[model samples]
Structure formats: structure tokens, C-alpha cells
Target: MPVPIPGNPLGYTLVYAIDSPKGPVLVDAGWNHPDAWAALRGGLLSLGIEVGSVSGVVVTHFHPDHAGLAGQVREASGAWIAMHEADAALVKLMRGFAEEEHHDFQADMLRRAGAPAEEVGAAAGQRPWVPAQPDRELRDGDLVDVPGRTLRAIHTPGHTPGHLCLHLADADRLFTGDHVLPGITPHVGIYPYDRDDVDPLGDFLTSLERVADLGGDRLLTALPAHEWIFPDVAARAAEIRHHHEEKLSTLAGLLADRAEPPTIWETAAMMTWNKPWEDLPPMLRGMAAGEAAAHLRALEARGHIRRVQGVDPVRFQALDS
Candidate 1:
């Protein structure tokens, strides 16, 4: 049985050792906190395994919660660390960007979105960036040969461009990272430096369909950065798809109400009426506005919305009108 880590919103972390012919391989390394590390070690010990027994560490993505202690584990167990190649660059980029550029980027984004100056300053203070890199790079459809199991990498970019989900062939199990969560929906906001060509939301939708095509019987387990293990994979995918569709409808309705095209900030305010601008944290407000902007862009691509560039800024409105 996988042990539950109390107080964690994701319920518990699963620390199971697979009996591979080469040795026991660990799926994900837990957090770097002393308590989290101790709990994982204790859980492994209860299963009659030791830290030295782990052969390799396979990560789904580069998020801190999933890959934070990977380096530490590699040092302790001599396990080779592996992650997606696309994400490897992100891991390196974020580490360097966090130290120098993250705060300013956060502040500027919020400031542009009409956040109060003081709120923007305070929100910039809360940005947390990890500083680490992966030792090995895995790619889409790459076969990770473990003892008695072959985990296939499925690139599921949205929440992050390099996000990956591992599918175990024989076990019929999929290790979904933050790509798909059972409880809370995953965040799919645009990165400040992200290329316009990369449609994360579209990629996410396609990835969900791909996972659904993998068969309904597949036992799904996830390492949600903040949720519990969920079994119903296909249903969850449908829920996410429906959620995005509904958001598009809502955006369309909002756009129809305004005679003049609305800026991203103005559109976002209509979308999040319950959460006032003054009360929202800077990062959240920026993310909310960005998400609205992404929806607008997607709608524009579909010919449902049109963008009009003004002297001062670009604005958007429903296309049919």
C-alpha cells in the first residue's frame, strides 16, 4: 500500500519499488523537504526496501514538486535521473531565469494587466523558482526499459511545454503528472517568453484524446503537484475538455456585450467578477488575465473573435457582431 503524506493536498505520495530485472526503479522523487524525504524513506523501509536499492529515477516533468529531490536521490542511491528532452531545456532555462528575470517578469505582467502598483510589487515577492537540471533527457514515444516493464513517454504539453506522462505497457498503468488531475484542474496559462506558435491548450486537448485512445481499462495514477491518485482517466479527460469549451462560450458571451473591443485586462475583469482586482494576488491576477487573453487568441483563430489594434493597445471582441 502506498503511504499517505498528511497535510499534503495531493493526499499522499506513492513510493513503490518496481521489481525490475536490473533492480528496483523509483517513479518520482518526492520533495526536498527533510520531512518529505524522511517520510519517503520511512515508507520505503516499511516495504522492506532501502534507498540504495533504487536503480533509476524516472520523472514525468520538471516541476519542483515532482523533480525537486531527484538530484538528491541520485546522489544518495546512485540512480540515473531521466526526464523529457524538451523539458530539460526548460529546467535549465527556468533555473537561470528565476534568479535574474522572474520577479521583473511577474511584476511587468501584472502591471500591464492593470494591477495596482503596490499589489504588483507584493506579488513579485511571492514568485518561487527552482534551480535544478535533469541528468538525462527522455522524449516522446521513447521506451524506458525497466525490469519486466516498458514505460512509454507521452508528451502532454500545456501546463508546461515539456510535460510528459509515462505509460506502462504490461501493467496498463499511466503515470500522469500535473497534466491531468482528478480534483483541481491543472493550470494552463501562457508563459511570458513562450512562442506564439506553440498552442498549449490545443496540445493539451490533443494529448487528452491520445490518452483516451490508449483504452479505457488503463489504470491511471497521477502525481498531482497537489492532489490524490485518481483512477477514472477518460472521464477526467472529458471533464477538462468540457471545461475549456464552456470557457470559450463564456468568453464569446462577454465579447458580445461590449460595443468596443476589450483589452485583455478588461475582458479578464468580466470573466473573474467575483475575484476583485484589488483582492487578488499579483501572480494569480496576471495568470487570470493571461488565460483570458489565450482564450481570446484561440477564439480569434476559430473566427469567433477579432482583434483590433489601436494607437495605445490591442483590443478584441466577438467576430459575428
Candidate 2:
């Protein structure tokens, strides 16, 4: 069912529910807003299920849009919430953050990305909301607690470290959260922007192939969190991968043509986006910079580029140049 997210451009999040012996197990709960809560309750009622009677909630990831209402669901129905172990840990980490600390971390990341003073100021002070802790920690291939049905959790960490795509083996349906959306490519970014050790884009690319192989010979009907359901998850994965590959090439070429290496902020502004960088909002600019950082990290790992050390804000140069 579509749970409305008031004021959000994406409109609503599609929260899927599977009937179990205990009650209905939700694939995802919508955003945490009064309007969203009302919509979720109403939507469940329309399906002959009650929000207060939901047996369990299987979160796709820790993103607010997807996992925001999970805690409320448990509060209302005593439902058990499950998430991938990595994301659960992330939530734990976020729980320890003070509002100021969260704001400062983002502000520092923006500064490190070479954001201007005004932009850095604009990006700061937006407090982070920590989602409710998950009651159950799920691992890849773990069977969900849905009696009589075989629902398997596939850990597909890219967009977030603990993202999971649930597989309904009995129904041949794959609930592909944000990992494989139909119209939009999921943003694979390095959070804590200073932590350059992990390669998120690389993990994302590998995850795409991992989920694609789940189809094997038969096509798995994909039910994503946003947009309508579609068939052939593999094709969609390939398309998203190609888009990133093209983006990587564009970034590398941009670096090669530059006389001096550009900071992530500069590189992001120069790279192509749906809208011009000047028009992008502060939040979007951060996302763009993060996307640039992830791609640059991938390129560095592949020997296509090298990071320039001893810089305030990190910069990169194309080795092939």
C-alpha cells in the first residue's frame, strides 16, 4: 500500500505486507509523520489488516523514509522489527549522537568536501533523528519469522551498510527496497565523509550482481519500495550499473583535463547532475559531493586515479592522464 509522506517529492513509500499466521508482516513502514501514520493505518484497513495488529516489520534499510515508522509500529502492535546487522549497529551508533555532534559531523564533512562557508553553515544544524532499535538482527539468507512462508533476507549493503532485499521464495517475488528502484538509481555514498577506507560504490556494484543472480533461470518479480512493481531485476541492475560506469568515466575524464586536481566539492559541481550545481539545495550538494567521493574512491582502488595527500580537503588526479 502507498503511505503518503507529506511534503516529500517522492510522494509516498510503498509498504508491502505479507500475511502470516501471527498477523500481517510488513516489508516496510512509511515515514514517521502524523499524515503518514494515518495513511498507513487507513491503507492497512483497506486491505483488511489493522496497523495495531501487524505481527512484524522487516525494514529494508535504516533510511528514514523506509525505517522511520518501524518503532511506532512496534509500539502500536508489539510487532518485532528486524534489520540487517550492519544497519542495526549504525542505528546504535546514531543513538549515541547528540544533536550538536551530528550537526558538527555534517558541517565538518561539508568543509572537508570543500564546501563554501555559507553552504557549510546551511548544511549544519539539521539534527539527525535516530530510528528505534531493531529487536532482531538479520543476516543474509536468514529466514524471517513468517510462519508457513519462506521469506529470506538477502543482505545487499550499498546504499547503507545493512540494506536487505527480502525474497519471498514461495511467491517468487523479490522486495528490492531502494537497492534496485525502477526509475532512480540508489545513492551509494560514503558517510562520515572523512572515512575514506571503505569503498561503497564497489560494494554497490557487487551487490547488484548478487541480487541479479537470485533470478537464476526464472525472472523474479521485483517489488521496490518506491514506484510500481516490475519484472527482470537483472536488467534494471545492469542499467543502473551502466549509468554509474558512465558517471565514473565522466568524472575521470574531468580530472584528466584539469590542470590541477579538483576537490570533491569542485568535482561535484563540475560533474553532470539532473540540475545545475548552482541550483542544487544544500542537502543535494552534500549528496552530490558524497557521490563524487564514492566514485573517486572506486577509481583510486582501480588505479584509474590517485588521491593527493597532505591536503585540507582531499583532491584526486587521474593517473591515466
The lDDT for every candidate, in the order shown, is 0.70, 0.89
Per-model clash counts, in order, read 3, 0
Give the runs in model 1 whose Cα sits over 4 Å from its true position: 1-17, 99-103, 123-128, 193-195, 216-226, 272-280, 310-314
Report the lDDT tens digits of candidate 1 across residue range 250-279. Answer: 889889988887766677777853468667
> How does model 1 fare in lDDT?
0.70
Which stretches of model 2 miss by more than 4 angstroms? 99-103
How well does candidate 1 match the true structure in TM-score terms? 0.84
Clashing pairs in 1: 10-227, 20-147, 21-147
Model 2 clash tally, residue pairs:
0
lDDT of candidate model 2 versus the reference: 0.89
What would the per-residue lDDT of candidate 2 be over residues 164-200, giving only the tens digit for each residue? 9999988889999999999999888887664668988
What is candidate 2's CA lDDT for residue 82?
A: 98
In angstroms, the error of model 1 at 213 is: 0.3
Looking at model 2, residue 18 earns an lDDT score of 94
